[model samples]
Target: MPKQKGPIPITGTVKNTTYFSLNGQYYERRKSSLTAAVVATDPAFAASRRCNTVFATAVAIARTIYPQLPTHKRIAGAFGQLTGRVYQMVLKGMDADSIVTAILGE
Candidate 1:
């Protein structure tokens, strides 16, 4: 990655409201949720209640940017999906927002 940019500033009240709604659900769904994904990827990322809070917040940000994703399917599974090599290559060089835009459209 070159230099990652700050999050795009959504425009107008409509966009703001839309983002709020999407973010709210994303936060709620994963608030108390934890997965082996974090544990395996970041050893410093301990599996604790606080970790879930941060994970939920991260999930919320991802969801707000990619509202089309199915909430249930967003969580990691017994067999990881996006964490795999294929998914990584497909999304290579793309920031999360760009990836969401490519996958889910505007």
Candidate 2:
């Protein structure tokens, strides 16, 4: 993970590494070979599968509740913020059943 400091900035993949510029700075990272199918079906990606499942459930919950709310302005990232918090809770070992109960409970 070396920062690119040279005057001549190189961006894009070179062998096993990838270079990209962000906020006027350049950095390199290892290229990932993972794909959606691999993540879904691979035992090595069980945690990712769990997280994805939780995120999808969170999205569904939001969808059901969103239409019932009063028409109020929302922040640009509000949707992501809501779902991300749920995903974080999942990562922190919150039970899926408890999450569903909390969200859909009266």
Top TM-score hit: 2
TM-score of each: 0.24, 0.55
The C-alpha lDDT values of all candidates are: 0.43, 0.72
Where in model 2 is the C-alpha error above 4 Å? 33-37, 71-73, 76-81, 84-106
* Residue 27, candidate 1: C-alpha displacement in angstroms: 38
lDDT, candidate 1, equals 0.43
Candidate 1, TM-score vs. the true structure? 0.24
lDDT per residue for candidate 1 within 58-78, as digits (tens), equals: 454454544356576566551
Checking candidate 2 for backbone clashes, the offending pairs are none
Least well predicted 10-residue stretch by lDDT in candidate 1 = 23-32
